[model samples]
Target: MNWDKRYKQNDKPWDKGAATPVLCELLNIAPQYFHPNTTALVLGCGLGHDVAILHAAGMVTTGLDISETALQMAREAYPDLGETWLMDDLFNMNSNETHYDLIWEHTCYCAIPPKKRQDYVNSVFSLLKPGAYFIGVFFTDTGQPPQVGPPFSTTRDQVFHNFAKKFQLVWEGKPSQCYPGRENREWVMIWRKP
Candidate 1:
């Protein structure tokens, strides 16, 4: 389904209504690494709760989602966030070279079609500065086929293998707690551009 329709109908089950606790915990643990003023980009930012968190922390934050409706709702809900909400596809992000220090990949990988997974990795690599990082959660569905998704089931091995050429998997582990339904199935990954 188109993302615009999903937002218009409020069909985004992926909207956790707040920033992912794993991301919050990571930032807290390594505040010096991901401090305020870091240039950050959040892909598939949905209603932008995490973007708001980044903005409040004083980062130069930009949020990109394909849906204009979602971006509008994000702006309305967080009027004071001062985030740059861009209506653009992640695969086609025309960002300048080495533009971001951090790329926050919440649910964008699983949301994309399986055939385009390589493109997703390439886009992330293209947007980040060398040695910059991508930090966030991903779902792993054991034995599930690629066609079964939006919250597609992905394996940790798949993610590592996909990014190995361009990124080094620096940190990875399951979170202490995930949002209601996503208990033990999520993996929080931190990948650095090499």
Candidate 2:
């Protein structure tokens, strides 16, 4: 379960090496919503492609990950980002009542142990300003669970149900192209804090 070691070994199958297609589509379809200067946070930003893109577009972006190796790689790869790359467990993030306008949750939810799903939801909710938005992409599958997983699979209903208490589901759909291994299994979701 040493994620840093896995990244060091170049074993991250979840690292698509690019910004997610769904995120790109979101930016394209609603450019006004994803304003360049909006304060944004990205959870579990592995290689940081999304972080770099947001930074380049002028957002005050912060990328958080548990693995030092991944953070180092992200910093080195996008030195110009000048992003706040922090090595901290997402569940343990203490923003002290400060909230972000947008939170980009790409692969953090399903990657966590199932028992901690609610905590993840609560933590993210705690970090968002009232009426702020959260855009997430979750993986779904019908097969047996993997022996070891950072890319775990979850059902769409479960995700919606979990967030319903604290958020309103504004948009939910699937993008045309996901990374090779995730095609047909990703749900693009947009939720707004109440």
Candidate 3:
């Protein structure tokens, strides 16, 4: 795949160049969404936007991606924002020493193939401590044609169907801030791992 090349060539359109308001608000205003004791794991954390936001808010954050190129760029760009950065696929990751309190799902969900979404959900459950939180921001409706991907489309029902059994639905809504074109098309979700 051209996943690594996308960053090497600077061809990433999915990066809004900053953390979403859902993340920022949780850190800055909505303390109800997360606890200070929580450690965060940010999946597909290309370039550390949300990583920085979480770290700055005093949460221990780890940024993981499948691309070494992307991880290098993230470390180089924002060394102070992330507590740890790893190059690993979410599906294959395991940490015997640590279980996170909050898992941040940003671009990773939509980037993977639709059929593997359950794998993503399972990974999240395995990595989190019980009763922890999963904060997901999904692109509910994509205006792009079916052939266009990297950002695949999914609905609220799909998300609920995948996560509801293992995770208790805490809150679901729209993000307070999104990229320039993603205003109404996004779904901001919070679920607690049961």
Candidate 4:
């Protein structure tokens, strides 16, 4: 598969090897939103690290990725974490039409081609239950879009234009957590379904 080749070559520089610290902070800040019964979906959950975090938080979690190789690696790395990890196309996967309480997004938005961004937003909105949460860490572009893709850069305004119509902007700011050089390179965004 296209994505599987990257893992076969061990080329996933984007894998940080752990859940984003901002996700932990979100849980701490809004403990009420995450509970044992709460269902959370992690989109493009490459190595299932964030899925493990959600599992530890006592929420029913699922890790979905389009890459089977990534899913295999994640299952091996986090075998003890009880999570439902699946290989599915994000644009096609549905939560059995049940929707989720929270959608955890990290690096997924920036990875998609700009042309498909609208599709991404529509997919997320459709998969969330009314009044649910969509917490994400979006990669921001310092300037114009790059010539190559897969890690396309974006801005806050682009994000707002994409999902703000369907989801309410709850929080938007630079994240306190970063992995070394990524201090101000990404935007921590939270949106709620109205």
Candidate 5:
């Protein structure tokens, strides 16, 4: 998919204007996992809402996206966060720049083609500091045919199969709050790289 062109055309149906409530709830319920020195990488951080949330929580947060337009929009919207926006492909991040204490996944996982799902898991595993966390709100069911997606639907087994190799499950459950249509479709998970 031409993400830059999509951003250029303002065709982002997935660009919710704010951070996922799931992240907020996670912070509220598990504050011990986040701290001022924590370095967080938010994948596909379109418009920067979740990045802002993580920053506000006192982590050194970086919002990374493949679309320059999306990063530009993020920077414009959060001008004080000048250094927080990064333009890079998730799969091709600079080797020396890959370490992070936390990686926050929201729309990025489901937005990628299904065939790349395992690579996504491996890439995330390779980017974290030992025992660092991988926290995300995944779209388990998009209510569309399973085969048709950019926002692909997935199952708990698939999640386990992809992440079990390198991550230890910390916590996971459906969030109490969600964006309008996401109700039971969203799954919030926290994993630690051990």
Candidate 6:
């Protein structure tokens, strides 16, 4: 998908204009899971809302996106946290560079083409420090055909197959809350790098 073009055209349907409801609820109910001053990276952080939420929770967060326009929008939306944004392809990030203590994923996994899902997992695994956490709110039942989309459909098995072996599963289940149409379609999972 031409993500930059989509952002340039303001065609982001996933741009919900606020932090994800599931993420907010997770942080609210389990603040102890996140340590203050720790580092975090938000993949496909379109408009920066979730990044802001992470920062507010005491994480030194960097919101990364493949689209410059999306990063621009994020900076405009949260000027005080302007420096928290980064523009780069998650898969292309140098594996030897700075690693993070936490990584947050929202729509990023679903947005990538299905063939690259394992690469996505590998890149995420490579980006974190040992014993760090990876928390994500994934679209497990998009109500679409498996062959269909940027917001592609995913199965429970696919999720576990890609991530469970390398990262120790800490928690997995339905999110406590979700966006209007997302009820029952999303799964919130937390994993720790072993």
Best by lDDT: 6
Q: Name the regions of candidate 3 deviating beyond 4 angstroms.
A: 81-83, 145-148
- State every prediction's TM-score relative to the real structure: 0.93, 0.92, 0.92, 0.93, 0.96, 0.97
Question: Candidate 5 vs. truth: CA RMSD?
Answer: 1.1
The C-alpha lDDT values of all candidates are 0.83, 0.83, 0.83, 0.85, 0.88, 0.90
Q: What is the lDDT of residue 190 in candidate 4?
A: 85
Model 6 stretches astray by more than 4 angstroms: none
Q: Tell me model 5's lDDT, rounded to 2 decimals.
A: 0.88
In model 2, which runs have C-alpha deviations exceeding 4 angstroms? 95-97, 146-148
lDDT tens digits, residues 52-171, model 3? 888777778889888888888888888655448978888887654579989998878989988899999999999999988899999877887534675888889999999987899988
- How much lDDT does candidate 2 score? 0.83
Q: RMSD for all candidates, in order, please.
A: 1.8, 1.9, 1.8, 1.9, 1.1, 1.0
Q: Find the 10 residues in a row with the least total lDDT in model 5.
A: 89-98
Q: Model 6: how far is 157 from its true place, Å? A: 1.2
In candidate 6, which residue pairs clash? none
Q: At residue 122, what lDDT does model 2 achieve?
A: 93
Q: Estimate candidate 3's alpha-carbon lDDT, on a 0 to 1 scale.
A: 0.83
Q: Can you write out model 5's per-residue Cα lDDT over 27-87, one digit (the tens) per residue?
A: 8988877778789999999999999989999999999899999999898999987689888
For 1-194, candidate 2 gives per-residue lDDT tens digits of 68899999989977877987777777778676478778889999988988877776677898989999999999898887775797888788765555899999887787788778899999999889898999898877724484345566788998998999899999888877677667788888889999
